[model samples]
Target: MGFDTATTTLLRAILDEVCESISRHETGVRAHVASKILEAATKGEKTPDGLKQIGRAALSEAPTMWR
Candidate 1:
């Protein structure tokens, strides 16, 4: 799906915020969280709070390699 520039920008910002919140520096983990947030955005979730919730939820559920 082709997202307009605004939505694309919003998603990027949201993803960056989520990654920052989680203190995630790994490229793979960041990409995974970004993809999850993008999926939510594509599904019509637009609010930053809602997107952040989705991202945090995904992070909480994601398996830890070291754990």
Candidate 2:
């Protein structure tokens, strides 16, 4: 199993943005959303309600950019 540099970079960037966003959501990422995201991530499934997406949305709504 191997990942190209581009994929690694993209993942890193997304994670960075997601983390920053999570730190700022007033409503917060609920336990259920986190759980679903974790499960999908662990299983390597295509995330339906992806945490990154939700996080970025919250971030964009507030004070961050998902760059």
Overall lDDT per candidate, in order of appearance: 0.80, 0.48
lDDT string for model 1 (1-67, tens) is 8899998898888878777755555666777787899899888998989999998887776668612
TM-score of each: 0.81, 0.36
Clashing residue pairs, candidate 2? none
Which parts of model 2 are misplaced by more than 4 Å? Answer: 21-51, 54-67
Cα shift from native, residue 12, model 2 (Å) = 0.2
User: Who wins the lDDT comparison?
Assistant: 1
Clash counts for the predictions, in order: 0, 0
lDDT of 2 by residue, 1-67 (tens): 4446764464545555565535434334433334444444555744433647754554445432322
Off by over 4 Å in 1: 21-25
